[model samples]
Each structure stands twice: as C-alpha cells, then as structure tokens.
Target: MSQNNDNSVLFGNGDELPSNASDNPHINQLIDGVGRRQVLAAGAALGTLAFLGSVMPGAAVAAEPAAKGLEKLHFRPRSKLPFTAIATNRLDSISVPTGYRATPFIPWGTPITGNYPAYLSDGSNSAQDQAEQLGMHHDGMHFFPIDAQRGGKKSDHGLLVLNHEYIDAPLLHPNGPTLVAGKRSSAEEVRKEINAHGVSVVEVRRGLNGEWAVLPSARNRRITGATPMQISGPARGHALLKTRYSPKGTATRGTLNNCSHGFTPWGTYLTCEENWAGYFASRDTDLPRELSRYGLRSSSRYGWDHLKGDEFERFDATRTTTTASADYRNEPNHFGWIVEIDPFAPESVPVKRTALGRFAHEGLVFAPVKSGRPVVCYSGDDSQNEYIYKYVSRDKYRPGRSNGRLLDEGTLYVARFDASGKGEWLALDIYDKKFQQACKAAGVSFADQGEVLINTRLAADVVGATKMDRPEWGAVNPDNGEVYFTLTNNSARTSVDAANPRPANAFGHIIRWRELCKDYAGRQFAWSLFMLAGPEADSIGPNGKPLTADNRLASPDGLWFDEEGRLWIQTDMSGSQLSSGPFGNNQMLVAEPRTGELKRFLVGPVGAEVTGITATPDFRTLFVNIQHPGEGSTATNLLSTWPDGPGQRPRSATVIITREDGRRLL
Candidate 1:
C-alpha cells in the first residue's frame, strides 16, 4: 500500500480516544447499541479464537458467531484458524485452507518474450531483456477472461494486467550505477529503469487438469515508462503538461508507482499512480516558485535530479527560468492521474483520463450502471487525512456492449461528510463559485477545466470536503447498493470528528454509504460507519446495539466483493510499532456484508503488504499479490528472511490460491 500525503497531522496523542465527544444523537445511539455490545463480544471472541489451539492452521471449520448478523462459517475446521497464523516462513508457499494449494504463477522478471532467460537476480539483465521480462514490484492486478462463452470457466485463459511499480535500483543494476559527479553512469541505465516501470499484459490459460499457467502468445505485451500515452478528458493539452516529448501537452510517456487498481465496466484496466512525487527533485534555490506549484518542497528523496538528462531531468519540476517553456514546471502535471489500458488490445494507446480528478489515486471502483443514467466511479486519494472522490460520467453507459468512449467525459466530485450523517459530492469545476473563489484567493488563474482537474487537490480543499484517513481501495456491494471505502490507518488522525472522530487510529475503519434512491450519480447520500478497526475490545456498542466479530479489523486497505457478494478486506500497516508489536503483520479478511459477518481469511508474512485480490466467477480460485516483503529493511541488513533461502531477498509475486476440495472461498 502507498503512504498518505504529508500535510496530515495526528489529531491526539497516545491511545486514548478524543475527549471532545459529539453530543449528536446518532453517535450516542451507535455507541449505545452496536458499538458497545460488539466491542465486548469481539474482545471475548478474539481471546477465544486466539486461544483455541485445537483448530490447526489451514483446517476448514466453521466459527460460532458470538453475535448476530455474522453467519456461521460453512467450513468448520478451516474457518477457525486465527488471522495471524496465515503468515508463513516458506518462500514460495501459500498458507490457505487444508484442501487448498497455492502456485506461484509469475515471479518478478520472468521471461515474457520466450527469448529472455529466467531472472538471475544478479542485475545482469539488459534493457531489452528487462523489457521482455516481467517488471519489478508487482502491485494491483486483475485477470480478464478471453472468452465470454466459457461461463466463468477456470479452465479458460485470459489476459493478466499487473502494475510494475518502482524498480529496486540496487538490485537491478550491477555494482549499482556509477554516478559520475551526480550524473548517471550511462544513459542506457536510465533507459533500463524507465522501461521497467509500467504495466505488463500476459496471456494465461488453465490446463485440462485445472492448473493455471502463462500462455506465451503473440499478444503478450509490456508497457513501460517509455510507452506513449494520450491525455484525455478535461486536462488534455493543458499548458501545465507541456514537455519536449509532448510539446502540445496532450500526451506523455508512461506511468509510475502504479499501485492498487480497478477494472472498468467496459473492460479496461485502471492503474493508479502512487508515490510518483518521490521520483523527481527540484532544487530549493533554483526554482522556488515552480517547486511550490508541483508540491515539490525540496529535492526528492529518490534523487532522480542527479541523472543529468532531459528524460531524468523532467522528474525535477523546478523552473530556474521565468517561462514554463524554459523549465520543467509542467512535467509533474503530466503524472498523478488514473491511466487506463485495454489489455486485450495491446496496440491501443493508454489514456490518462483527466475527468477523474488527479491526486495520489489509489483505486477506482465502478458502480453497476443504469442505462440512460450516468456511470459512477469511486476513488480514494491515498493520503493521510486526504479525501475520497467520485466521478459520474456525463454520458450514459449504453447497455448490451461497451462502446469504450463513455469514459472520455465526466464530472468529478469530492466527498463531504456532514455531522447529520449526510454526505455531498462537491463538483470540481473551474467555473464553480467555490473553485473560482479559491483560485482568486490563492492568486492563481485557471485557463479552463484542464487546470482545475490538474490541480484538483487545491480545488477540493477550497470546497471544505471531509478529510479522511488515507482512503485507499473502494468496493460497491451489489446486494445492498452500498459503497464501501477503506480508511487505511492515519498516524495523523488523533481526534474524533463527524467523519473520522477517533484518536490514535491504529487500526482504521470502513465507511459505507447508500446513494440516494440507488442512483450512482446522485449528489446526496446517507452514510454510516460500516466497521471499526482496532482490538475487538475497542469496537463494541454501549448497550443493545447489534455487533459482530467481523467489524473488528485493522487498517483496511484492499477491498473487493466477489460475485457471491462476499466482501474481502485486506490490511496494510507500517512502522515497527504497528507491524511488530500488538498488531502482527498485514492480513486479508473476508466478510458477508448483509449479515455483517467478517472473519480473518489470511495474513501475509512480516514486511509484506496484502494487496491486489481477484477471483474467478466460481470463487474456487483466487489471486493475491504480496508486495514489497522486507521492504522496510535495509538491503545490507535485512529484518525478514521471507521466501527464505540463502541470497534470497523479498520480491513481490502473485500467489494463486485455490481450495483443496475445489470449493469456493466463501
């Protein structure tokens, strides 16, 4: 998972909840019934679940519901396993239900061209070889079926689009690149790194015996940072995006820091750009004015500025000269937007849809479309105390078949949570009075819609939207028409408020809302706290309110709902305090939304983030990505010996999880 923005501050210090409590009746009602009761029962249940040593890990067994609303597990022996027990010492094995098995499908740098040799991990691969091989740091992913006639067949194959985030330079380059007095050792080295940072589309199929493998077809394609992409929607051709490669400011050459993703209803891959800000650096003295606009407070931590070339120099947004044409002021503007790719059409140019307001986009979930009505999209800003936003396409989604052009136009709105439990979707338009006033106050002039979309964060702040704890992935419950977003933990969120009132939010919570009259494009909605993270003891009702064990989870990150309406929740935690101490490591949990029944399904090893979950229609097989294991440790002195072996270092890989009995995960 990606870190939130830098502006957020902790609400209160220590573990205690904030003292300035709300007098609202709804808060009191929640505290009285559901909150208090659930906490108590969850506390007792956690103790029992942790202490029940008889239930061996991976055994399928149903768990007795300590509270109502939570359904009993169908597999008694398997469901009883504690959430923490899923972590394993084995390098290439998955800890799943007893009957299940996990196969490592595509490891980092796997050959895709059928010509490149397997990854040796010694940094000897060439730029061409790396391009033909799988990119490093695999994050959000989705599996698309090639044949609709197969009826969700596991035996059928499809295309897999996986985001290749930043590369491990130290691991990828031999003896590390030799910086010649702050310049890159060679231009080829820069080329290699750029070519290694994007998305990979590989053809995959299942064998007759039900085994899944990559199909080395001619359609296999690798899109890297050098790949040309078009700018679309409101921000296309904006002056802010002007670059030598894209002099018209309507096109750019890549996506970086791709994180959690979403699949479009029209069958396109949505790859979010996270932590792209760290790739560039602007000198404090050289371009002070330009640096401020692009959010570059100082030189970047990654030090791409020292590369001494236009390709590397574009990362530096600082402008030494007064004119934008003379410097790279517009470079940063080209990035930080949701990039869409049609994996099926390898030749199609990827598009950066500006209709979706730009920021640190984490994920984009689409609501089921209604003909003649606008299509809705939910996205999280992925920063501490940042905001959650939605976009409603002006064009209606035509039924029967996808036209693929509907996404080109839309109105993006940021969310505002009111104390009355109502929420509003604030439109982000340059012409809006709120936005105009804000721009005037900031002493900035916008030429058109493009500027507003490019500078969306500033526009949203002017409207006073509710800030949340690093909102990440979002999922819509088809059964209830409720939208659920993961409020990944915020070290800065210390005090309670109407939206996020809790102090010291170690384990974050989930916020769910029902659109007015089930209209995805509606601006008004009713909202409620769906689940609270922390120890089970902390999430309970005061008196008669209903509660369930499923509500108690920590730092909710990746979220998805299977076809059966089973909600899968994944956790992401950082800092030694959260990762090592009381909270073990990140894990994946499963929940049934209607019943409010949730259970710990699986967990990742130390230093790994549980992310990118997708399932076949049958739910018999699942795919999850383990990202950046042992990431926090220094390369010289590692903290975790994961995927263990001599000379073995943590590498992000996708795990294929399936039930041993070939049963569904629910």
Candidate 2:
C-alpha cells in the first residue's frame, strides 16, 4: 500500500499513542553537536584535489583523508558508471538509459504452479486460479542461482522469490469488491484477495535467444495468506500466540503484507510482515498491547472479517469465548515477524523466527557473514518515528552447518544513536538488568524473553531507543561492513534530533554506520547521514550539495548493494507528492559510494512505486518490480495501462533490464 494512503488504519486512529515513550531522552540530542563537527572537519579539506571523477553536472567535491574503521579498509578500483542519467518524466511507462533494454515478465496473474492456469484478462479468474498464479503487488525479491558452484557468474537459470505486499481490492475483481448491505459479500473475492497476498517462487531462465522465460519446475510454489506455517524461535509456544488454529501456539495459518525480504547463508528466504495490523481488527472496547501497540483498529483494511466461517472470521481478532485458545484474539500476535522459507524444498513449511522481535518489519539485511562469528542482521520498523533493530545470534555460524536455528536463538537489540556521532545497541533481552529496571520504572511488565520479543516496540520504548524518521529498507556495504538504512519521510515528526533533523520531514534521508572494530556483533558503532533525499532546493547529497536533476529523489525505500558494493536506491513517493513534486514517477538509481555520485537508472509508470530489486550474479540481468500502477483510479477514470499499454488494465509486473550490448550492467 502507498504510504500516503489513509494510513490511520495501518497506524491506529488519533487515540492510539506513538511507539516511543515521551520521557526517552535519546531523541532530544541525536546529531546536534556531532553534525557540526563533521561538517567543519570536511570543510578543512574542501580545497584538496578531487579524488573521484565528477559525474554530476557542474559538481565536484574534494576528497578527505581516510579516517578510522571502514575508511581504513582497502579501496578497490571500480569502473565508472557507464550510462548517462535519464531525465525524470511522468509518462506511464518504464524508462531507462539509452543502452538498456527492459522487458516485462511475471505480471500479476501469470500462472507458475499447480495446474498452470492462464490469467483471465477480464479479472474473471477464480480464487483457485489466483493460488496457482503470481500474487499481486510484488516487492522485495532475490534470485538464487541454480548452479551453486558457479558463484557470481551463474546468471542463466535461478529461482526468483518476490513478495506480494497487499491488494487493491477494486482492481482485483471484475468491477469492484462485491458488497451486500455495505459489507464484503463475495467469499470468492475475499479469498482471491487473500490468495494474492504472500510470496511467489518461480524458476526463471535466460533463453538462448537472449530472452527470459518462466520454466516449469518443482521449485515454483506460492505461499499465501492461507498457507500453514510453524512458529519457531523465542516466541514459539507462548500463550500470546495461542489460537484455535494452533492450540499449542506452535503454528499459524498464513503470512501477510510481506513487503521486503532477506536470505540466509544456509539458503532460506526471510519474508517480512509490514502493515499487517490493518488486515485484522477488533470490535472489543479494549485490545491487547500486542495488537494495540502495533496499530490494531476497530475497522479493517479489506474487511476480511466481514465474512463468516473460521477461515475469514480470524481477521476479526476479538475475544469470543474468554480463552485465547478458543478464539482468534491471539491472531494478531502470529504476524509481525520474519518468516523463513526453504525455496528449494517446495513442501517444507515456512517458519516464523520470533527471536528477531516483532514490529512493522520493512525488511531484513544481514551483515557479511564470517565462519566463526555470530550471525548478525539489521531490520527497520517502517512507521513514523519508529526504531531500528539488530539481531545477533547466540550460536556461531559454521559455514555450511549454519541454518535458521541460528536465528532461533539470538539477542535482539534496538539502536540508540547518541549525539557524539556514535551509537550503541541496547539489548532488549529479558535477562538484561538495565532493561529489566527500565521496564519496572515504566510500569511495563514482561514474564519472560518471549514476552519481551513479542512486545519489542514497548521494550525498546522503555529502554530509550532513538526514535527515527520512518526507517524502511536497509543494506550493508560488502567491502567495509558499514550498514545503511533509509529513513523514509515522516511528516508527523514535530521535533528535530541528530539522527532525524528535519521537523515534519517530507523528503527522507539515508543513514549509515560502521560497527566498532568491524565487529558485526559488537554493540558500539559510529554513524552519519549519507544523503538527504529531496529536490535541489532543500536536500543534501553526500557531497554536501543539493540534489541535481540527474538524481533527485524522495521517500527512499528499497535499497541493495551489488557484488561490487555499488548501492542501488529505489524511491516510493505517494499520493499527490509522487506526481506533482519535482520528483517524477518513482525511480531506481545507482550510486557510486566512493564518489558520492548518483545516477537515475530506471523510472516506473504513473502511480507506481519502483521497488523490489535483485540482479543476476553476472550483473547483466536486473529485475525490478513496479507496484500498483494507477493505484487510486477506477475502471472509468483509468490512469495507467502500463506493461500492457493502451486498452488493458494496469498490472504490476517485474521488468527485466539488461544492457543492450549483452555485457555487465554497470
């Protein structure tokens, strides 16, 4: 769903309180003194010779001497970015540089599993058909090479796994959602919509003629809102997770609102649940802190609860028989987690790793894994003024021997960015005495570690984690182990801090940090703002100048780093901001981290947010997803007919972009 939509449902109404506690002192002094020090230090070398080639128009920045930590890492020679930056436009189509070719593939209704049903053009496909076809609104994805030994050169065949975030009900049905007396009436329509929200695993191969096609294989599968899954890790078998479907609290029925994703070294997919609270609602006067803290409302987004039967009634999430196991009140606790799926094992059930804590997980990114160190990862809660988190496994990673069990036993920590340009990872573990005292003083109570993780937001709040500006997607630099997270716009922010300096920030920014001594599991780190996203007027680039036409962007969302450490950033501007601002339709840009240069790589159609990026190992085939084109428009006042132009309805699809010369994309 667009961030600018009526999000009161996703985040509760005005009566709902903010996640961060009012007494937390961490917010009052984020970057106040530190930013001035860094700016003055950089100005000292402003007259030095330019070390990196100038890529921006009439722009050049002098190089500064290497500092401690990541700056001391060996720098490798990198080839200059090859293509010219494209101009921003509001056209309803994909745009790329002059030497690139883009082809749409695996759009919304393309069948890949089961009986291989064909997509019905008039939106007449049944709910069963949708279960067999590609789900809607593709987001975070990864391409796993079939030829494992080939390493970074295998690009011919692989498994493509992508997320189906949410559905636009009006576009999924023949005319619109069926309504009987102002409530959803068609069970098939609701079922079809539910079937469309999950992940799609398809086997794709590059043909001999330089084209790509979905190949029928046993690896292709669909995990929808109805797919059964096991709840693993700390919160497993907890009373808060007990439901009629899983009386033991060891399992759940489905995964929903999967936005961004991650992949484990042991070869598993981690699909994150974001904005899932809006799907379930309650008619009760009071709701559990687990649901209420995560923004549960009295009304639902799609009204899935309006239907009868256990399958549909679970969405209500209200107390019926007083016992948690007898009703679906614990249903909300089953979501807001990182679910692990074995893509190669088609029949294996997905597991929700609760040790990673619960919140509106935008995505998860792992640090460069080492043979003997703990498996470490970072995640961001994608909401206004939420907190960023890191999870460090208690078990050591033993190369091929490592598995999702490493995630099952871990210590989750919330970030606390201080005013001295450094940060600390505050443990949310129940055993931590500091955290225990903080909870006691705040009048919050937790019975065990599982409760601490299940109520992670409240735990972070009492311990004074720094509230950020809508942290979204995160990426780690492969060369130096520096972590970068995009803080998407937060217009609700009324106070300025070091990490989030702009009050009522409309254009979000990127913040990066290098772990102390390059230890991925270490608690201390140094951080700084990488880029402030906006028009040339108010934004700040890494070079300390305003954004130029070549790379103007806002609402930075999806982020990833290629094999060479080149950062690729995607934008997600919504509502009137997407079309009317200096920014055009959402775009994907490639950034040279060393030179602080950004070039627009691709742009999507009107009303679509360009997200979910992954590249072939050979760096030749780049797959990007364009989600929800013509989002708010209906059949009569159509706004876009993209990928299948002119007369057809707009369908979200993955565009495969390759260099015209059939060479490396960079």
User: Taking the tens digit of each residue's C-alpha lDDT, what string does model 2 give over 1-666?
Assistant: 366446444221111234454456534245443332233234222311111122111112212223444334455777767789999999999999998998999999999999999988678899999999999889999999886424535789999999999887777788978887768888999999999989999999998888999998999999999999999998999999999999999999889999999998887899999888888889889877887788787888788899999999899888989799999999989999999999889999999999999998999999878788899999998887689999999999997678899999989999998756667999999898989888889999999999998999989888888988878899987656668999888877666666676667888888887677544788888666677888888777765566899999998999999978788999988866776978999999988776677889998999998999998988889999999888775655568998788877788899999989999988
Candidate 1 lDDT by residue in tens digits, 250-294 = 888789878888887767788998656666665646543223433
Best by TM-score: 2
Task: Report how far residue 453 has shifted in candidate 1, in Å.
Answer: 0.5
**What C-alpha lDDT, on a 0 to 100 scale, does residue 370 get in candidate 2?**
78
Candidate 2 segments exceeding 4 Å error:
5-22, 25-74, 149-153
Q: For model 2, what is the C-alpha lDDT against the true structure?
A: 0.82
* Candidate 2 minimal-lDDT segment of 10 residues: 49-58
Give the best candidate by lDDT: 2
* TM-score of each model, paired residue for residue: 0.83, 0.94
